[model samples]
Target: MYVLIPAYEPDMRMIALIESLKETNPQPGIIIVDDGSGACYEELFQTASRMGCIVLTHETNRGKGCALKTGFSYLKGIGASGEVVCADSDGQHLPKDIMRVGSCVEPDSRSMVLGGRRFSGKVPLRSRFGNSATRFVYARSTGVKIHDTQTGLRGYSTDMLDFLLEVPGERFEYEMNVLLTAAKYGYAIKEITIDTVYLNNNESSHFRPIADSASVYLPFLKFSGSSLISGAVDFVLVLLLHSLSSSLILAVWGVRCISALLNYTLNRNVVFFKESGIRHRTAFPRYALLAVLIACLNYLLLFLLYKKAGIPLPLAKILTEIPLFLLSYWSQKSFIFTLLNPNG
Candidate 1:
């Protein structure tokens, strides 16, 4: 097994982590990517190299994701078959925890391990809030409840090298993206609790709250943004058509056709466009079929809510959309807009 640490302007804590690892029996090979943490930090990187880590350097500052890929590429080139455990340079991940995560790696298994931290102590406000919001969004988006979605300690088997190289993100979002689609690529996620250590309230971290948060939350934000846009149009049209025709069925169907068109266009070109095989001329027909089916389901739900539940027409329409929203998201991702290849 190998440990990959991506460092940018790192301090002594990183050396302490490396020193701790060197004391372990049957010590793992370590790979450190010096992410352009220039002159002053060369001593730290040099000390790491003297301790037998294969230190790779970047001439300029590439993001963490790129640094990780660089480390993965190095592993691939060297024909390394063991697991690669990724840890931060901030001294958060303990050597034992890293070993625990790395031990889950198997030659034939497609599972990734995460060292989840329970923020039980006095956690930093930004760190606590960020994890909470990200976990909520991740659960709502993927239906998977991951406790610590912002953890930097993770393990990956060598078999995932090709796919990891393909997943897109140049910064912190890259890790989240990997989790977002890990199951889609046939990988099961396993989590193990680890020590939560936030030194000086994680003050040494380089994560920019505004810019990096935007990158990390891009997937959820983009999809929701599209939904809000289409929903606004649907809201306006449903009210207008119901007022004009005085028939719920006509209003629902007419507005659905228009709103579905706009939603599909946005989702196809913007939302799931990165999914393999989606940039072709294939998804529209499948999408149209899904839309028609949804229209039928939408009308039925509206009818039940309005007629049987004694709900007002507008309220019923709103109630009906809640369930259908999940359905549409699932269908579009699972069938309509996804790549055809199961193993790809």
Candidate 2:
């Protein structure tokens, strides 16, 4: 097994982590990518190289996502056998945890193994809230409940290297994008509980709260934009057509078909543009089927809440939409606009 560490301007603890890993029985092969850390950090990289690690360098910082891809490409070039695990250089991921994740990597199994960290005891507020918000968004969007969306401790079996290299993202957002599209490529996620250790309250992390957060949430934001615009069109057309034709069913169905087309166009062209192996022929039918099912459920929920439960129609419509919105997003992400890999 090989452990890939992406380091940029790292501290001495990373060296310590490597030394500790070397001490373990049947020590794992270590590969480190120096993500454009300048001369000041060269000493650390030298020490790692002298200690028998394969050190790859980038002249300028290319971001974590790119560094990971570098390691994956290199591994493939060398014909690396056994498991491949990635860990942060900030010392948050313990050696034991790294090995635990590596142990979970099944050969030829399409699984992304993650070292799940439980944030117990003292934790930074930003870290806590950021994780909570990301977890909520990921779960609501993908219908996959992952406790740690931002964890750097992840393992991939040999079969997933090509997929990892193909996933889009240059920096912090890349890891999130992997989870967002993993299922679409026929990969299952396996989580192993690991310790949560924050050094100096995560001060060493290079994550920019404003910029990186926007990048990480870009897909979710785009999806929301498409849905909002489509919903608005649907809303306006429903009222306008109903006033003209005096047929609620005709107005609703007409608006639904129109709005779904707009949503599908935006999603395929913009929201999920990075995904492959899906075209209009395969996706449109799946999207339309999901839309019909969602429309039926929307009416069913509206009927139950408004007529049976004595709630106002306006308020019931709003209430019914919340679940439907999540359903729609999950279906589009995991089913409609996803890749189907024949190998995996």
- lDDT: which candidate is best? 2
Error of 2 at 295 (Å): 1.7
lDDT of each: 0.85, 0.87
Q: Candidate 2: global Cα-lDDT? A: 0.87
User: Where does the lowest 10-residue lDDT sum fall in candidate 2?
Assistant: 335-344
lDDT tens string, model 2, 261-305? 999999999998876358789999999899889988998999999
TM-score of structure candidate 1: 0.90
Candidate 2 regions with alpha-carbon error over 4 angstroms = 342-344
The candidate that wins on TM-score is 2
